[model samples]
Target: MDGHRIRVGTASWTDPSLIQCKRFYPPGCTSAEGRLRYYADKFPLVEVDSSYYALPSARNAHAWVERTPDDFAFNLKAFRLFTGHQTPAKALPKDVQQALAGHFAVKKNLYYKDTPAEIRDLLWHRFENAVRPLREAGKLRALHFQFAPWVTRSARAQDHILECQRRLAGYHLAVEFRHRSWFEGDAAGDTLAFERAHDLTHVVVDEPQGFENSIPTVWAVTSPKLAILRLHGRNAATWNIGGEAASDRFNYDYSDAELGALVAPLRETASLAGETHAIFNNNYGDQGQRNAATLQALLDGA
Candidate 1:
């Protein structure tokens, strides 16, 4: 069915607010394994947000493969350092921390540029190895690189993106640009062309606009293999606020009317790519899951 081609899901199943709300998971599904198992039964796809904060372990990946169904797929967010974000030293493995200490005084935060070539190579290797289980199991969909807001459309930034593709040679790479510079004027065409040339999937995002980092919604499909639609809600007031949790920043419940408006364009996107994944990122409580389910129903019924 056409509905099968368009997978709908949330950014993560284990968000703190999602668990605390006590609306989604059952009482018996308290354990991590039980939660994942239960979540997989409801959603065919899930984006791993935790991997962005810390490098995922091979053991954990293996467990994920074991717990989920054969047809289930996972899209993992690239680690913060990999996506040009300031990563804390503690986020790295102990061995990597020691290695960084040998090169220079360990700082509170580290950037990709701050690390030496050897350290960078080591990280790339570890990241690949850690997620090998998912790749082998045919459950890995894409490695999402949501670049920092400061990463503008420049030769240097483009080079870094290309380098990432080169490192993860076999994996599907989904690129999400936060800065509007990437889609401004003539740069939009250039950016899309670059992604197509390198076989990178350009992630189309729905979020608050008017900010320097806010990118306009571009519906063009760069990769034939996959097209991603990420809805981050329209919470303009919370877009820039740094709260104790992610819910504070992404707190907006998408109304049914709002979701109905997206049906036609989303179907068009699905037609362009082999598969289209619409992932809700408004992760306050059960908002994402509820929205995703509603969107799925709308698409199927349409």
Candidate 2:
């Protein structure tokens, strides 16, 4: 592995399925602080999935910093609205919600374009301030922006991606595209080039393919600072299913052989970047936790 670091962990630590399964955590570890402490003791890295649905608060960020070790790292998912997702009006902060109430009188969902420039600026400020503690503590890795499936490869979509980077100028950003157009045919090279030019880390995804949103595993590292490999499992049947919980959609458990096959590519990615993070997103019961542990062991043994 040379001298580069490779941190392996699951995307979420507080998924209901993980807690309800009662397999990974000990008997007394029920509270948020206890669970975080326990999880940090086992893995050096974690991805904050909760930040995706709602904006993260500085208080929670401070609590996270206090609970984890100095060397621990966290990759936070960008808020849904910023990633071109259809966000519910209720997900906004109380003040923002009140301000948007009139605009959202008839609609339940809100898109990025639906917001005024001032509101967008306020959101960007709040998001940056909220994660300031993590950055100050040196525990912040990157903000993962998993764009919506509709954000295809086009000049406008590309501009929106660049705008995200511009808004959070100093922060490290990692991008994951759900639209196949970004990686289809010759466009893959162009996509990587854009990411490289902008110093954006390309999130290498491993998931079910053949669907409209499915993207092949692109092993190239666009940034030298960090590289992220997210495993979303191979559950093709559930990939595009609507009205299902995320746990149900990503329910496939990876076999040992399948995990073993990824060792070399993960190591190669680690060799190129300053740090490599392997995040398991198959949060079905204790599936992600178990797979992460097994993969970590396999990486160590190999």
Candidate 3:
């Protein structure tokens, strides 16, 4: 880490608003190499959100390495199911094959449209293995196992996280809770204790309403260690909105004041924790880039 805050960079350089605004890089200006270079030239860290879906190419990873400085860091969100969502399964108990979803092989059932838990485990396992190369290369900062909306402060969820932490060979696991129950006094303390016990950093989020996402937000719960902060530029009206989706609200710019609100907390967290990752999901035309620049200025001046 460079002072109290080692480095700060956008989750993605190609955010919609960045292309539209040309704050740092021009619109339509990123390839894996280009984007890596762009961030390496500015701040020294970034969040690789693309890996949350399909497996990325080895060449892509190498390109990222080629473009980055030695001190740069990358954080990845682990595969969806490994975080404790159903593995697409047959009557499996919590303590048994829970986090081991990655170990099972999914047998095809022609009768069903959805994937079976067995098959899902195989898939999630493959996904987890694929991410290892990055970690092996020293590119990974943390693997965030952000649980879905249904995961609560139940014993099963807690046990599942512990199991995953135990099995996850050589990675740092951070858990993000979506349901409100995970934050109640007893539950919240237990959850934070779990993180501290395993040395796992927690994911912090500042989401917009209507999304019905995590309560207590990851930001509020995070310890001052390594952290992932998601800023979901909120528009309560659009929380559950689904339609032709005309005139998006997220594309709106984050004014200096709004950016200031987030930056302040993050600065304090970084100072306290000794390191931090602040990611913006505002994702408007070029607003994220402008905000990243504004944030970088604040960090540099700090």
Candidate 4:
């Protein structure tokens, strides 16, 4: 850790399960701002998961900046619609939905390509404005774009990724590919090369293996500036199931043995990268906070 700054934290601090756990926060700290302050005191970094489900507001970003310490940082997930995911019409802005109605009959869902160029540009503008408060406060760590499984290895997909980078220019962007094809056979090298060439950080994932959509836990570091490791617990039974909430899919808790095994690899990654973040995404009950604390303790003792 001599040349690297390693931070350990969870993907979220306000999940329903986390709040219901009632152990992390004090009895008096019941408000959202209080929860953030309590979490920031324990962990130096966090990933804002709620932004992926809904549009992030500047008011909330400003509140986050005001609540946390100057050294606290947040990595936010880009909106689902901007990352090639099927976003529901109800989740969009009212004005945007009305504009879409003028073009076609109301559809329940909309893809990225479904929106016209002008509407997409407006979305980008709104997203930038929403996160500006965090950026100006020096609290924004990175903007994560976790692409859909359908966005595979192809010329069009490649071009669209470059287009995404262009649209969200001037921000430290990290790319996470859910599709297995991006690293299948000889394509892995090409994918790393692409990330390096574009100056995008590659998000390494630890998930249940053997599933078609499960990305292999490749430990390569594409960016020397920042390296992100997301530990989505190995719950294979529900990883690809439908009609379940995100918390259920990532429900497994890491045992002490599992956390101990990660110490060396995490330290190795930190040594090579300028900054490294290990985010525990297991949102079931109090597992995420427990594992994150355990890992941080191990790192500190080492």
Choose the strongest candidate by lDDT: 2
What residue runs in model 3 are displaced by over 4 Å at the alpha carbon?
15-24, 27-30, 84-125, 209-211, 217-225, 243-252
Per-candidate TM-score against the hidden true structure: 0.97, 0.98, 0.76, 0.96
Give lDDT tens digits, candidate 2, residues 126-152.
999999999999999999999999989
Over 4 Å off in model 2, which ranges? 1-3
Which candidate, 3 or 4, has the higher TM-score? 4
Task: Indicate the TM-score of model 2.
Answer: 0.98
Residues 13-76, candidate 3, lDDT per residue (tens digit)? 5554455456667466566567567667876777776554344445666677667877788777
The global Cα lDDT (0 to 1) of model 3 is 0.63
1 or 4, which is superior by TM-score?
Answer: 1
- Candidate 2 Cα RMSD after full superposition onto the native fold (Å): 1.2
Question: Which candidate has the highest TM-score of all?
Answer: 2
Candidate 4 local lDDT, 1-302, one digit each (tens):
23589999999899988888887888988999889989999999999988888889999999999999998989999999988998887778889988888544756788989889898999888989999999999888799898887888888988988887888777888988898998898999999999988888889899998866778988878888789999999999989878636788898989988988888888888888888999999988789999999999988988
Candidate 4 achieves a global lDDT of 0.88
Please list the C-alpha lDDT of all candidates, in the order they appear: 0.92, 0.94, 0.63, 0.88
